[model samples]
Target chain A: MLLQASNLTIGYGNHIVQHHLNLVAEVGDLICLTGLNGSGKSTLLRTLAGLQKSLGGHITFRGKDVGKLTNEERAKLFALVLTDNIAVENLTIHDLVAMGRLPYTGWSGNLSANDEKIVKESLAQVNLLHKSESLICEVSDGEKQRGVIAKALAQDTPLVLLDEPTAHLDLPNRIEIMLLLRRLSVHTRKTFILSTHELDLALQMADKIWLMGNDGVQVGVPEDLMLTGKFQETFGSTAFRFDETDGHCKINHLLGTLTVAVTGESPATLWLERALFRCGISVVPNADIVIEAHQGCFRLQNQEVHSIEEVLHHLLC
Target chain B: MNRTYKNGLLFTGLLIVATIVFACDIVFGNVRLPLSALWSDDVLYREIIYNFRLPKALTAVVTGAAISVAGLIMQTLFRNPLAGPYVLGVSSGASLGVAVYLLAGSLLPIAFVQSGWGLVISAVIGAVLVLLMVLGISFRVRQAVSLLIVGIMFGQIAGSLVTILQNNSNPDSLKLFVVWTFGSLSAVSWTYMQVLVPLVVLGLFLTFFIQKSLNGLLLGENYARGLGINIGRTRLLIIISVALLAGTTTAFTGPIAFIGMAVPHLVRGLFRTSDHRITIPGSILCGATLLLLCDLATQLPADGYTLPINAISALVGAPIIIWIILKNK
Candidate 1:
């Protein structure tokens, strides 16, 4: 095991946000922690990374209690990428990443040849070697995040903990970062435990999922958790239903026992049914109201509507 | 250009310029002495050279270096570009100390406030008091922006107290106090230099020890801890160093302005790096040179009168602060 938290309690001051929680992270495992707003995900990550004191219980990394280790020793075992904004100015990417070697370097933080090699390798791993000389302020947000991840990688720790690593990124960038993290775990065997709101991506890529909610914490693989109905139980809402097979959240609409036949083999017909479902209507062959959606037009109840908007207006009227 | 090569060239260039400035400051003052006067048979010229100009120039160098380094630490600790000893009320605290001694001590014997040790002690105590209060508030409020506001409030409080003292002071004492507040390097006699030199040197040495930790802090307190820095200890050390530098310099030469706040920015622009390992030393050298130049500028050679050193620093410093604000935006 890379890290294990047994019966852990975490919170700030006197308030306990999470209690009696147990989690075990194996080597090379990509664990994604998902929770609602203010659900102790960040607090738990901070505690496990040894950046904060746990109120009770023990966190052991490599079979040793975390509280007993000195700060330098803990740093050798864990590296963290937080959501804190980087405020430094005129700092190059190489210089920023070189700071990760503070635990191993001398008091002056002068990087040795081996340390330089490691910095380069980490930058290469993040695919940011080309921008190593660029100032941090000159880089895009996605590139800055990759630089931060590269800094964490340069620490040479066994486990890396990141909070909202894909928070502000677009879809392509978000997917790219997830793939990069997965690849790093597979190729370098470094364990990653990150908290994120990207459920579909988390479900697709994570080796383990830790879900936190009002019912306490649930830990399992994505498929097992979905099969056991724990995912829906933890994150279910009155407005939506969790699609178990497709791993998606869809609007929950009452069909009202009234259905309209949806005709035509094109994608327009499928979208017509979707619009109808959104309005609490369903598709059936024997219903009085029938709609046929061809290329740019909709035929509803013998009335030809040129657009989906017009079709919905005509059917509802 | 390679950053290392650029840093090396800039460091060497600063050293050369500081040396030239030091010599020029000693040579050209209110009384322009010839460079060959030391080797001449004139005993008065020798006395002025050894006892007056040399000490004054050295005082400027030491005070400049200390205050600039203090300002650099303040900028990093608060993560505010405008943070400095003067702007943060540390110097105002020193000024309040001097005000109390000069204005309130009027009821006592003349010898009480005139002693060099008395002034230095009172000023150090005052600066340390304000430093402790600021540190206390910073400990409670983790927000840098709020801490900055608190510092400015402290400055205002100290400034108002000094104003009250000035209003209540006698005319003779008020005139003396006004001149003192204007700042001067020539007032630092040989006796003060003995104390000032070692204190400034020690403060600069302490800066070297914390440079790496200061680099870790560039991101913020949380990230610094992740890199194994004891944030509380670092903060304490920084406060102590700033107090020593600012308090001692203000005590010896009065509250010299702008050198502390502007030199670090100048060094960063010159070196093009935010790493403190370079900036700390860079600020020290750049500070020494800039203040030496300012000292030279204060001497009205043609009119045989000197402008207030405080005025020159503000003239030089205020624009730099404005530029930094605009650049950051």
Candidate 2:
């Protein structure tokens, strides 16, 4: 195992947030940790990174107790990509990434030729080498995040822990970051433990899921966790329901005044049902009002409606 | 790579400017001695050049470099652009010590407290006391800005205490205290430099040793610790170094301001980088040049009367800082 935690308790001061946890991460495993707000995700990541003291138990990496390792030793073992806002002025992307070699560099932090090569390679890995000379403030948010990840990559540690790496990104940027991490884990053969709220992406990409909830942490493969109802148990609520079939947590709509039958090809019907459900209309079989959703139009009671808006107008009116 | 080359050229240019300013400070005092007078056989001219002008010039260079470096360290440690050497009340603490020693002459042995060493010792004690309090509070305060506010509060408390002392002081001592508050670089002779130079050099050396950790801190404390930096130890080192540099300079110069608060910003604007490896040396050189120029302005040939060093520094530094703010904005 690359890392193992047994009977670990994590919290601040005397208050315990989590306890009696046993977790293992093997080489090349992309473990996605998902939890609701205030579920101790950040605390667990901090504890695992050895940045914070665990309340009890031990974390060992490669059979060595992590807490016992010196700071430099631990730095060589774990690299981190934090979600903290870095608004540093005048520091260029290269300068920021070059800092990752500080653990191995001399006291002056003068990067050697080898260290320079690594920094460049890390920047190139993130496709940020083109903007390496640009000041951090001049970069886009997604580019800045990529620079942070490049810094971690330059650190060259076997284990990388990212806390909400996609928190401040748009959808495409979020998917790109997740895909980048997946590719890095596969090619570099390094273990990754990242906490994210992107459940669908996590379900599709992660090798293992550490689902933290009020009851404790449930650890398993994503499909197994979904099949066994762990995701539902953790995330399902009165306002929303976790759809295990598609691995989506959808809002639970109330029963409406009208029940209509929605029939068409898949995907269009799926979206039409969602739209009808959101408008307080229930989709059922053998109803007075029937709607057929197609590629560009919908057939509603033998009238062709060009849009969901017109269909909703006919039904609601 | 290209930026390093440009910075190297900039460092050399600043060095040349500092040297020119240092020479000007030594040569262009009220007496207006020529550059060739150094080799002259006139006893009075030799006395002015070696005894008075040289020490004052050297003091200006040292004071400026030490205080500005302290300011840079504080700004990085607190992560506040407004943080300066005196922001933590070390100067106020030093001033309070001097005020008590000078104003309370009737309560204590006049001869002992009147000595130069006695004043320095008292000021250092006051500074260390405040530094200890600030350091203790730092462990409990997680936010940098909170510590800054606490320091400001401590400064206000010390200032009020000094006011009370002044009200009770005799006229002779009151006059002396007032002059000391105006700040002077000319008061530090070679005897005091023996103590001041080594301490400031030690502080500067300690700063160089932690340059890497200081750069790590640019990313903030959590990210720095993740890079294998010991946050507590780094903080302790920074606080101690600032105390040594700012405290000793304040004790000698009677709380010179503006240079500490402004020089780092000047260097940052000039170099356009916060990388400590460049800023540390850059601050040292730029600070020395700026102060030398300020001191020279104070001593413009005018019937042997000179402006207060504090007034001159503020006059020169405030505009530069304002320019930096507007330009960066």
Candidate 3:
């Protein structure tokens, strides 16, 4: 096990977030902790990363007390990428990433050649080599996020923890970052535990999902979660429906499957299925609305609709 | 360690140069003496050099080095570009002491015979009192903003009282207050230097031990703790260094202006780095050199009556600040 929190009771200044939370993540495992805002998702990540003090219980990493190690030693074991934007102004990407090598450096903060090599490699791994000379403040949001990840990779630690790494990203950027993290975990054999609101994306990619909902905390693979009905319970909410089959979240289907209307000029093959569905009809593989007017739509697979003349003929006959 | 060692070596070189400058400034003043006559201990040259010039030069060198180091520690501890000896109003409180002793005549019984000694003692007391107030406030408020406002308020309160005392002083003592306000380096006797130099050296050595801790502090107090720095003690230690340096310099030199605030700012710009390993020692050298230049320029006896040292510093200091603004823009 790379890290395990033993019944850790965590809180700040009289308010407690969670209690009796126990979980173990192994090497090369990508885990996601998902919950609503203020549901202790970030708190659990902070507790495991040793950034926040555990009020009652303790966290152990590799059978050693996380609290017992010296600060620099713990830094060698785990690196965290918090939600805050990097504070340092005007430092280049290379300079920003090199701070991860500070623990290995001497007290004077000078870097060795090996440390320099690691920093360069980490920057390249983040696909940021071309941007290494640019200032952090000059980069876009996605680039800045990658720069932070590069900083963590520069640490060369076995365990990396991030809080909401994909919170502010758009769709393509979000998938790209999650995939990058997945690739990093596989390539380096390091464990990554990131708290993300992107449950469907995480469910598809992660080795295990540490679900933190109204209940304390649970650890299991996405398939195990489905069999145990934990996946539905964990992400089940008032406004959204979790489609476990396709591993996606969609707006809740109200009266009938919330049908989409197709009204474009061509696309006739797909258009008939869409018109049927728009008028409060469901799409079935071999049962409802037989196919006609097949030129308008191309991608709508197995649904059919009636022509205006057929409706009139049925009424007259 | 090698870099710190090299920095120490550089410090020794600057100390030597400062000592030579001190001797030259003292031995060559307004009155030019025949070499043979001066060497034979001529009455006029001998009195001027021994009684007046030597004390004055020593004060400038020592105060420059001490306050510059203080500014370095202040900037590091607060992680602020503008932190300085006077920004905390540590010197204003000392001025209050000078006001009480010279203008108010409140310590006549204690000073007894030496009129000047009363002012120095009271000034030291006043500065230390303000130091305690700052230290006490720092514990409750960690943000630089609150501490800065608290310091400014302390200075304003002290300044108002000093003005009141100044309005009531007699002519002879009023001259003393006026001279002190303009700031002269000739107030410290050799006896005072014996008391001050060792303390400054000790404080500076202590600073070297915590150089890494100070660097960690640059990240913020929480980050420093995450790096295992004992935050409370480190903060107390910084306060002690600033207080000792500021208190001692203001005690004898009467709050030498511009050097404390401007020297650290100028040094950082010159070095193009913020790492204290270079910044602290660099400030010392730059500060001492600038003050020596200012002190020399103050000797415009070419006009038959020289300008005050503080006036000369303000003249030089203002242009540099304007240049800094222009260059940054």
> List-wise, what DockQ does each model earn?
0.67, 0.72, 0.21
Q: Please write out the lDDT profile of model 3 over residues A1-317, one tens digit for every residue.
A: 87878888887758888888888989999998887677798888777766668887778888999988877787788877778555442346876677677667776666788988999999999899999877776788898889889888988889988888998889998999999999999999989999988877987888998887776877789878766777668667777756657766655433365333333345553545444544444546554324334443322325333463342233233
Model 2, A1-317: lDDT tens per residue? 99999999999999899999899999999999998888899999999998789999999999999999988888889999888888876889999999889899989988999999999999999999999999999998999999999999999999999999999899999999999999999988989999999999999999999999976899999999999988888986799877757878889888767899988888888888888899989888989888887777899878998888888889888
Task: Return the number of clashes found in candidate 1.
Answer: 0
Q: Between candidates 2 and 3, which one is better according to lDDT?
A: 2
Q: Highest lDDT: which candidate?
A: 2
lDDT of candidates 1 onward, in order: 0.86, 0.90, 0.73
Ranking by TM-score: 2, 1, 3
Q: lDDT per residue, candidate 1, A1-317, as tens digits?
A: 87999989999879899999999999999999997878899999999877778999889988999999887788788888999999687889998899888878887878899999999999999999999999999999899999999999999999999999999999999999999999999999999999999999999999999999864799999889888988778877788877877888888887766678888767898788888898877878778877887767888777788877887787677
The better-scoring model by DockQ among 2 and 3 is: 2
lDDT of 3 at B216: 56
Candidate 1 vs candidate 2: the DockQ winner is 2
Q: What's the DockQ of model 2?
A: 0.72
The DockQ value obtained for model 3 is: 0.21
